[model samples]
Target: MDYFDPAGFCKVGDEAGFRNLRAAELKHGRVAMMAALGASVQHYVQFPGFDEVPTGIGAVTTAPGSYGFAALFLVSGVLELALWTEDPKKEPGNFGDPLNLGQYDIDMRNKELNNGRFAMFSIVGIIAAELFTGKDGIDQIGLDTPTL
Candidate 1:
């Protein structure tokens, strides 16, 4: 636990609290990584009818109207409540590797945690850059804006 929380900012005192914190960190990191990927991907690829949707934060609002958001909420709720509910007996973030990549060693896990932390910061930076500059991530980096 010290390896992940050396500064003790999490204020985790016990093993259960540390496990919970680890789970939360893993979830946030996964989300951040996906968000970072989406931020970059949206600039290049958009759905069939969403070509006119402005990239970056604006795209979130154009998510197929209210139904899209509601459906997403429903699906996420199901996933959270049914599929990935926490089990005290299991190790934190030990959700099975469906693909069976077999990279669950300590070194790999540490690498993933580090990468996730970096990704969380990166997504925040990307969103901030987009908000300030009014450009998607790809455009902000001076990449040629490809026609949709």
Candidate 2:
């Protein structure tokens, strides 16, 4: 019943395996954070021509039609094959900061990892709540109400 592994479920047996796991977790967290942001933004903002698109889950289901899915698949494949090829010598998620965004210390890295993990859970909860309640995140949490 360790603080980090209360279930004893983390079975990474070696450093290399742990690095790979961290990299995967980081990548998934980044995607989840973006998805959660996109879902929230969709409630308040949309492109000019996309007015007909429904909000919430309907928007996710409808906007990405067959062609969109195909394009996404192809582009994702290219990026994964070309850009995301991992380097074993590099640190787990240290795919260099291109913007020269100042120092990236261990503290910053841990914060990013923790935030990403939280976001992963958040996105899942958001989708589940929307599915069960039939309401967007804002309405689901009563944020739609206005008070004076």
Candidate 3:
């Protein structure tokens, strides 16, 4: 139920986190750390319950908007991992099961499992984006309906 404090998370930059990485790198390091922590923490703590609802000022003032996207990707990553693990039909050669190429038929479960790896790619992309975008830049990405 606790939210991440951007200021507190970013304190690493002002302290002893990345001394050699340039100013921008240090800032991005803090942002990446905050984004990852915020996403994982918020996903398990508030996902499915508060994701669709608005943050009543207290939450918004505490965690930045990037946390929201991070939460999204975090949930997505979890779901993907779940999908990957839940299916027993998934195998190394079944990667094309989703293609439905004649005998290949089209296994939705296998497809879902395959997508788990793709989802990981997305998670990495989310982290990289957060590093470049900072705390509030996720809002400007156009999904700006504002949930929290």
lDDT of 2 by residue, 123-147 (tens): 9999999999999887887766431
Stretches off by above 4 angstroms in model 3 are 1-106, 135-140
Provide the clashing-pair count of each candidate structure. 0, 0, 0
Badly placed stretches (over 4 Å) of model 2 are 1-13, 63-73, 145-148
Ranking by lDDT: 1, 2, 3
Each model's TM-score?
0.86, 0.81, 0.30
Per-residue lDDT, model 1, residue 121, is 99
Candidate 3 local lDDT, 52-125, one digit each (tens):
43332234434454576578679867854665332224432233446555564346434443454355454466
Q: Write the per-residue lDDT of candidate 1 for residues 37-121, one digit (tens) a residue.
A: 9888878887787666777887667756344557867998899789998888877887877899998877877777888999999
Best by lDDT: 1
lDDT for position 2 in model 3: 16
What 10-residue stretch in candidate 2 is worst by lDDT?
Answer: 1-10
TM-score of 3: 0.30
Clashing pairs in 3: none
- The lDDT values for all models are 0.80, 0.75, 0.43
Give the local distance difference test score of model 2: 0.75
